[model samples]
Target: MQLALSTLGCPDWDLERILSVGRDAGYDGVDFRGYRDEIDVTRHPLFTDRADETRSRLESAGLSISALSSSITLCETDDRAAHVAEARRLVEVGDTFDVDRIRVFGGGDPEDRSRAELARAGGETMREILSIDGAENFQWVLEMHDAWTASDDCQQLLDELPADNVGVLWDAAHTIRLADETPRETLDALGDRIEYVHLKDAVYEPDHNDATDDGYVYAVPGEGDLPMADVVAALRERGYDGWLVFEHEKRWHPSIADPDVALPAFVEWFRDQR
Candidate 1:
């Protein structure tokens, strides 16, 4: 699999720095989640008015825009129009950069309702977005996040909307940490629909003095408990040849290591596996 780094890790870096550092760090592509503290790339001038320049710069550097990680959530029943508009804007930006996979979330708060109910709503919402003209060229990837971390719940949504372009964005950290699923179990249920993968690691610390409310904290790729080797091997066994994106979420967790340290470390670790 090819290696990519998300701009979410380098929240302070501009477009120029993203391209330069990504190429220098030996990343094959960059996932555009945010840049220079701006989470909405559609509003960022680099993707709006300077989109051509952005594309040319990446091409010149021999790198690719792997995917555009959007904050769009489909599980919420309210604000349907707003969500669809946001997805369209992301689709436009992604098309400009030749990115085929756009990451969205199933924002089902399980505390409020059942996973099945949320999946039904999310499936309808995903279908609406996929029905748009020209949307067939892109895959709307619903990540294993929030209430959808459970592989079976993800399968429910997939069953509801049987579309070729609809797929899953496998987040290894969430499946293992939140859903208590082994990599093998997750792949067995959703591997056929996994269009992209988010690679992150964390140590479970339910009783640790310093732990996130989720009872875990992000760790560098190889330094934590995630089954990275097994996940990669499973993908290979399935003939999956997509990008393994290092989703170092320093943008949200400021205490984590900077992209300068995290980015190169991922490259080295991924290369070692090869």
Candidate 2:
């Protein structure tokens, strides 16, 4: 698997710093979750008006824009038009960089609506987004997050979407931490539908903690309890040669290790495994 760094790891850095850090750390690419203060990076000038310049910078840094991580939630029933617009904008940004994958979230509270209802809504929403002109140029990968942490739950939603261009962005940590699933079980269920991955490690703390309310504190890849080794082995066994984006959530959790430290640590650890 190729290694990449998520800008979500270093929210304070500008594009130049992001490219520099990623290059020096030996990453093959950078996943754009956001840039600096812009959570929706498509709105940022670097991705909008100056996208070509940004692409040139990436090329010079010897890194590719692996994927554009959008905040487009697939399950929300309200603001359908807004969601479609956001997806369209993302497509434009992605096209400029020649990146063919966009990350989306299965975001809805399951307690408010049943998994079946959310899955139906998400599928419908994704279909509309895919119908947009030029949407077919990219593969939309729904992340295993929020209400869709379980492999079976994701499969129910994936069943409604197109198998060829729509797939799962397998976040192994979520399956293990939230759904109590092993890496092998998640791989078996999702299989080839997993088009990309979000690599992170976490320690499960049953009690409330500073890192998260969900009992999982983000850790540097090898320093946590997330069965990351098993995840890698499972992916290798399946012949999954895809981007493993180190999703260090330093943007949200300021107390965590800085990207400068955590990013290289992940590269070293993952390379050692290989």
Candidate 3:
């Protein structure tokens, strides 16, 4: 598996700096949110016009664009239409970089709903996203997050979708956070639809004493209580071959501490994997 870093960690940095930092830190690829201020490549003319130059720059510096993250969410009613529009635009951006995957979230805004409402709405949002025509070569990999995470619900979704492009980006934290399930259960439901994974680690605190995204607290791979070793073994045993990205949402929480601090630990842990 080619290891990569989510540039969502340094939301304030530009593309040049983000690419350099990730390359220097032993990352094979870097995922970005080009639509946002974080690495705002969308604003650059070159991002749209000079594709070869951009790819050349990154390749020369030892990096590739993994995916343009996290622009999709399936939890809000009012923003659902706008969500579809934004997804099309971001997918175009991904096409520009030849990146074929887009990171997505389970919660549109689940903080505003009860558990039942969130599940119902989140599933609906996912269905709409899956119905989009396949123009962009990338696929809609619905990342399992704190919201919309039940194995039954996810299976129900896959049963309804039409194309093989609709799949899962299983985050280890979300599987562990489910009060009634295990990682094995979630992965089993995914089956052939497991497209990629958001590799991370965290402390096992129930209301998440430090968890910012709330499935669990974020930390380096082996730094916290998350069953990183077991999770790895399970994926390997199950024959998962997709990319395993280190997703540090320091932009949302102080989880990473510092890039200088966190990146090295991540590289070390990933390299030493059995």
Q: Which stretches of candidate 3 lie over 4 Å from their true place?
A: 34-36, 39-46, 49-53, 106-136, 204-210, 213-216
Residue 246's C-alpha lDDT in candidate 2? 95
Q: Rank the candidates by lDDT, best first.
A: 2, 1, 3
Q: Global lDDT for candidate 3?
A: 0.68
Whichever of 1 and 3 has more TM-score, that candidate is 1
Candidate 3, residue 199: CA error in Å? Answer: 1.6
Candidate 2: tens digits of C-alpha lDDT, residues 77-124: 796788899999999998889997999888887899988888888889
Q: What is the per-residue lDDT of model 1 for residues 169-245, given as tens digits with 9 covering 90 to 100?
A: 99988888789888888888888889899988777766765456788767777887778877888888888899899
Model 2: what TM-score? 0.96
Q: What local distance difference test score does each model get? A: 0.84, 0.88, 0.68
Off by over 4 Å in 1: 205-210
Top candidate (TM-score)? 2
Q: Residue 64 error for model 1, in Å?
A: 1.0
Between 1 and 3, whose lDDT is larger? 1
> Candidate 2: how many backbone clashes?
0
Model 2 residue runs over 4 Å out of place are 205-209
Residue 212, model 3: Cα distance from true site in angstroms: 3.0
